[model samples]
Target: MKKIERGMAFASRHVDIFKCPVCGEGFEEVMNGSFSCSKGHQFDFSKKGTLYFLRHGVKSDYDDIKMWEARRFVLKAGLFQPIIDEILSLIPEKNYLRIVDVGCGEGSTLKYVEEQRTNREDAYVGFDISKKAINLATRDEGSAFFCIADLAQLPFASKSFDVILDMFSPSAYGEFDRILKSKGLLFKVIPNANYLIELRHMLYEENDPQYSYSNDKVLTLFKRHYPHAKIKKITYEFPLSKTFFESLVYMTPLHWGAAAEKIDAALAKGLNKITIDVLLLIVENN
Candidate 1:
């Protein structure tokens, strides 16, 4: 079956979680492969089986197809398996779950999570601002409900989700709080100082300011929003092949601002192994 057909079926099963992006009204049902709100604002499912919720187009540096494909390649190679395991450990052992992945690029992470939970009934929804990313996400049939949505203004109903996953993505705490249940958990992952250090060194000199990194500001901001939030530091190294290293180089935004020569240098130098250092912030909505 086509993606739009799958999406329509999925929406029919879980239509209550969606809200009209324009009018903030609940979607009553799926009609003609589209969701129509009480206010008459309708969002049609694309041929790829994804919904577009952004009122206006937003361009992003991550919109390139090659970048997203590279990311999907790396993720599928099991480089991020450890992080995914940690996220699964935090989820409650419930019979049913409603989960959303904010800024979920290409839906790889969400798809992995869905695959791991075979015995339970769970609803997985992933959204990103990049249309290309969402389109790529729909390639995997029955993976999840993918959509193009703005994090600043989510198109989900209030208190609808049991868990929120933000993996290496920007946070919209206010929108998170609104969509998450009162006791819902949010597992946010942010890069640490030593994350991809090999590439960092290649991109800049020791004395260059960009060579060093810190997550102090991001931690402080998160703490300010969730004073009682818990943090877990995950650090490890994954061996890399020359082929896989190339994917890593293109998948990350770390090279976006670097000079062409620097990227070329990094690719030429290659990497034996890459560090996977990140902090996982687990917060509960009170």
Candidate 2:
């Protein structure tokens, strides 16, 4: 089947999870390659088989195709596999699951999760604000669905999801609380001080404020919101190829503000292995 047709079919099968962003009405049908709600708001499926839920254009540095491609390369190299495995281990075994990956850039992580659990029946939907990201995400034919959406105003219905994955992305707790089921789980990943330490050292001088990093504020805020949250620290290193190293430099935002000369210097120096230090916060909805 064509990409649009496959997307429409997926939407038709799982239309209950969707809500109109404009009027908060549930989608009633998928017709003429579009999803429409009873209130008359229609969202058309793109040629790539992805839906756009954003009413306006939102500019982001992550909208670059090259950056997303670089990310795909790095992720496919198993650099983040350990983190993904940890997340999978935490998810409760079930006959069926409804999962949504928020800020799902390029859909690599969601795709990996789906690929790991082929025996079970589950619904996987991923969304991001970047149209470019969603377009690229839909390129791969998989059971997972991709869409362009705003994090602040999610298009999914309330108490709809069994699990929510937020990987190195900004948190929309209000929207998260609304869409997640009563006994749902939210797995949020945040970087630690040593995450990409090699890259950080190469990108900035010792005296530069960017040379040092901290997640204390983020942890504090998360604890304030979910006082009973459980935290797990994951630390490891993955060997890097020359090509993979270059892709890593392009994939991360750490070098975005650095001087060109510094980035060049880092590339010239090269890296053998990179550290992956991160904290996973697990919260259960009451």
- Each model's number of backbone clashes? 0, 0
Query: lDDT of each model, Cα atoms only?
Result: 0.90, 0.92
Candidate 1 collision pairs: none
Give one digit per residue, the lDDT tens place, for model 2 in 1-286: 8888888988899888999999999999999989999998899998888898988878888888898999999998898999999999989888579999989999899999999888779999999988888888887778888899889999999999999999999998989999999999999999999999999999999999889899999999999999999999999999998999999999999978899999999999899999999999999999
Which residue pairs show collisions in model 2?
Answer: none
Q: Which regions of candidate 2 deviate over 4 angstroms?
A: none
lDDT, candidate 1, equals 0.90
Give per-residue lDDT, candidate 2, residue 13. 91
How many clashing pairs does model 1 include?
A: 0
